[model samples]
Target: MTGQTPSHSERVDWLRLARTRQVGPVTFNKLIQRFGNAADALDALPDLARKGGRSNALRIVSREQAEQEIEATHDAGARLQIASEPDYPGLLATLDPPPPVITIRGPLVPDDHACCAIVGSRNASAIGLRFARDMAASLGRAEIVIVSGLARGIDGAAHAGALETGTIAVLAGGIDHIYPPEHADLYGDIGESGLLVTESAIGTSPTARDFPRRNRLISGLALGTVVIEAALRSGSLITARFAAEQGREVMAAPGSPLDPRAKGSNRLIRDGAALVEDANDVLDILHQAKRPATAEPPAEPYDPADAETGDGTDHDRLQSLLSPSPVPIDELVRQSGLPPGLVHAILLELELAGRANVLPGGNVQQAWPEDQD
Candidate 1:
């Protein structure tokens, strides 16, 4: 509708819209697809949120905040990599709502260089640590890049072993912040020889909520994920789950059945993940892994030409079909007997309104006003 802006200005607008209130990656993509540009989407959020049944004012990150975040990124010796950039890792782009923006420090390892994630419990055993380190070193020697959360236990050990070769530490906090406090030196080393990555913007601190999201990135950036040691309840399991959902190979090293830290890995092996004892095992599995061709995301969130004015009727149908449980969007389209474009429009409205949670695999889980998390 107007003259095109320069790429730098375009990036700024993209960051601003991505940092906006109620605009998660999926929502952000949909908004861009529907409205045609970030500036327009940013202009439209207030009305969108109001229609979603929000009472309080929307809290979009301001231009000042976005600018400050970019400045902090530069100050920390990192740079922002947008999803649309050729420099962005290809494997990561496979996720449904691939990170819209990522801050990277150190060398940008392309997804073509095989990457394997080695993660497990933070409170790891000495033997577990040793095994993780050794496995990482061997993988590195084989020219495979290691990826892990920069947490304690297996993650740190993995990086330590692979530091000389190459590794990536995906952080849960801002690109500038380090969690657990003790890994400061390790963080520095990785930033020098390896890479540090995060979806968090500058000045943000890590929270319990951030780790699961971080774990997803760790798995996503790799061709396969290797769980060294974890309890039945651990973030490593979550990463493995993400690997499975993303159609990547999920591998786990066997541990003593008696050790609680081994339960998760053993379970993974039992549940169909490849059992990897050494780097060779992982290499073999990865070699055999089909490694599906990454699908291109829709250029438009939906075909706007097919859009119809939706109201209470469409909303009611969606509500009846949705529950606390997450279901694929395709199923909703099928069951509701509604046009896919109309379903997307209604869902977009509900998402901005805070009545829905868009999960991975194009599934959506509804949130009742009474039980909003």
Candidate 2:
């Protein structure tokens, strides 16, 4: 939880701050903590970026643009939801800062309802598709919601099987931007019955980079992720990795070793993920593990005193110690011999300047020129 349910004006400010360039999920949290609210953070961006070594002012998303997004979302018959709302999924709400805002179509289920992600090869084998379909159908019958990236093959099959029940399609692009063009009918079906969720803004088409972020939401919304058939390089594995990092169950449907499509799932099994033969196996694990008691998102936001003011020399020294390789922030504090608060402040500024990357688990890395591009 981040703060109380936002008022109409607060929601607009939130959208603007989030849509601002170089303001990622992690930075969004840091900005809120440092500035006490999005409006203040929005006002501070120019000064902060200049202090962080930017020659020109940072491009903050405008209030007019934010307002247009709101209107367009309304026109689409969808609603824009902030993470602090009660309808926002708990599994996502508990993530650090969570997604600041998401555009959603259809109804949102309560956090207590079970959500399991089924993902695999977009070029799935017939047999693999059948298994995924059956598994999703069974899980749907048990009142579980299926979450998947609405790609072709296994994902489409899973949605089809669970159509009678409820499913959530997390698009790689905007909630209104349907990728793979062929799934337009399926997309409509979901909006009418299931839910369509996306962090991307209206009218934004997805690129290669968008899928990984989309994969994270697939796993984040679910209690577990199920891999039906994935090659060694399949994107489904990325979703499983996110699930594991999020402290959720990772389940895989075993496939024969001879099949290349099975390699990822098989390797996952060897690495200690649960082997799920069908939806029954998944339900059993859910029953046994049970959902952890989720803490409500904070009603009172944390405002860090002076978390953005830092010495320039000390900040440079800290930047010199970091590379693209992930290093713990605590280690940077120790090695740079800078005060922890100063280090945090410097990192926050660098992030807003697009000069840093904060990995999960309290790690930080330098964003190389290529990464910035």
Candidate 3:
């Protein structure tokens, strides 16, 4: 590693790579792995997109835009931290599609131990809210960093209870923009005492789709995710799914079956989520689980130029194998009778050209805009 941190140009490249259209978390990681740093990835983007079959020019964020975002975040008293930064949350960095760049407010404390995520319905019942608060407070006292989405009811209660010790609120919007409007004060408090983080650029507002993505970060940043009260189809369940996918523990607090909100937690319990009754239960589970360690390997140097292999025919074959329906990349390679790297390169080109969408589970599918269809 260089004695100096990555240069300003490199950080700008990282931001641009993150903001690039069709570049989701998985694709972003692959690009970084293939090209040593984001700068090289940015340089290689145009050709990559062309190989992906883009008829029109690809859209890449400009340096000016990234600079403006940096200024805005600094003006808001927050700073942007990339995944490889020292302050980046370790558990979150382990995620396959971890946020490449996150804006954070307040001091980024390094937890000596693993953190646990506590989340639930925004409209939690009185009892559920109290239970979440008490559990969070106990966890805080036990020196566990509490992590949650800064939503209403249970999430809010959890953060508030853990504030005295420490907590982290992962937001759906830009760090400067507070969502749900009503939680503006809570957001400020968190910025003061705890950590507030978001992947969105400055001034960006939360959309209907962003919250689920945010929930994944909440769960991804911890050793376990705890659902206090949630509906069966609520976003909390999505967090649980992400936790399970990332091989993190999923825990739920049971409630009376009579309440509609209880169904989510109860169902999770039935689905084999650890049954969490109190903070002790959480502590016990974490104690039995592996301790927090830096799981990332030392940064390896790479050259994007070296990654290029002449495989025009292979690219065409991979293109012919894709459909609107998402299919795992592994499946594509298996069916295409091509090397995995060649298949990946072809898909990367398609993605850059806006002709493909990479889905979870290493899936790649055709991305046909509504107008085109």
Candidate 4:
């Protein structure tokens, strides 16, 4: 909620807290809102996790490790951009729970230049790839910045089309690591002429789990998302979903019913996504798309003096209510008859202990160690 420039020590603390195990973006934000700063939150994690039922010591990234990560990021020619900073991307800031720390490898594109995400299957058909590239090029010429994950097929084509004008490749790995290694040249070119972004830390490689998190960022950075060709379970659909959840436009290029890759996009159109035939179609959507206003600073997490740590009976009551299914926090508040603040505090503890998954959009699900992949 504050815009004061963080000190070096503050930066390290932020990174440390952000890198702590089980502390995802939503949890991190909650901790910050409650504690007002990362240093205090880092100090509080042990007790929090213990209350949440962790049998082992909660793994918190050490100051030394965090420092090494900063060093590694610098060595890779990238810099950390914290969410509280004035320079953080405006569109990205509007996300309900934006990444606390993201590593950027290029100059910040101005907020005035609208961005659109183009995503689709990694195994795009030839015709689909051509459409994606041409659409991106035309959008670029019209002053829209293209955003995509630098994968094979449609993603690569989109980036290549917009590379000269402006493009952003959102990586699922560290700024230092490249996935689909064949795109080394494309990665380098984008870093030089456009921008590269990621939530991953230095030296961290992309895993299957990372892409969905990365997809959210792709949609978060843009005014809208356009799906070129995607299957029912495509990652591109994930990006479009995120765009819709963030209140941004979701557009899809219609494809043949016979092509499996088109199913997702076609389904999107059927479900009310804007139909995109060409760049002009996308442009028309953008013309009507409302850019989010500059975000107001978030509310304080809670007042420490007024907060109450619930007793054992209250904890047991909440535990009995939470099954493996995801439930809205408000439902927990109502069902348990606990104060909203106490419920969140308990949930934070459960999340830290790895006993629960605190997903985006305020959903919580049971997550025992055995349940994790």
| Winning model by TM-score | 4
| Cα RMSD to the true fold for all candidates | 3.4, 2.8, 3.4, 2.3
Best by lDDT: 4
**Tens-digit lDDT track of model 2 for 147-232:** 99999999999999888888999998888898779999989999998899998998898877578778988988888899988999
Q: Which runs in model 4 stand beyond 4 Å of their true positions?
A: 108-112, 294-309, 316-325, 334-337, 368-373
Candidate 2: where is the Cα deviation over 4 Å? 108-112, 292-309, 324-331, 368-373
TM-score-superior candidate, 1 or 3? 1
* lDDT by residue (tens digit), candidate 4, 24-105: 7888988888888999999999988877777888889999999999998898889998988878888888887888899999
lDDT of 1 by residue, 140-225 (tens): 99998999998889999999999988999999988879876899999999998889999888778877656877988998988899
How well does candidate 3 score on lDDT at residue 21?
68
Collision count of model 1: 1
Among residues 3 or more apart in sequence or in different chains, the pairs in candidate 4 whose N, CA or C atoms overlap within 3 Å are 33-301
Among residues 3 or more apart in sequence or in different chains, the pairs in candidate 2 whose N, CA or C atoms overlap within 3 Å are 1-297, 1-298
The lDDT values for all models are: 0.82, 0.82, 0.80, 0.86
Clashes of each: 1, 2, 2, 1
- RMSD (CA, angstroms), candidate 4: 2.3
TM-score for each model: 0.89, 0.91, 0.88, 0.93
- What TM-score quantifies how close candidate 3 is to the native fold? 0.88
Say what the RMSD of model 3 is: 3.4
Using lDDT as the yardstick, the better of models 1 and 3 is 1
TM-score: model 4 vs. ground truth: 0.93
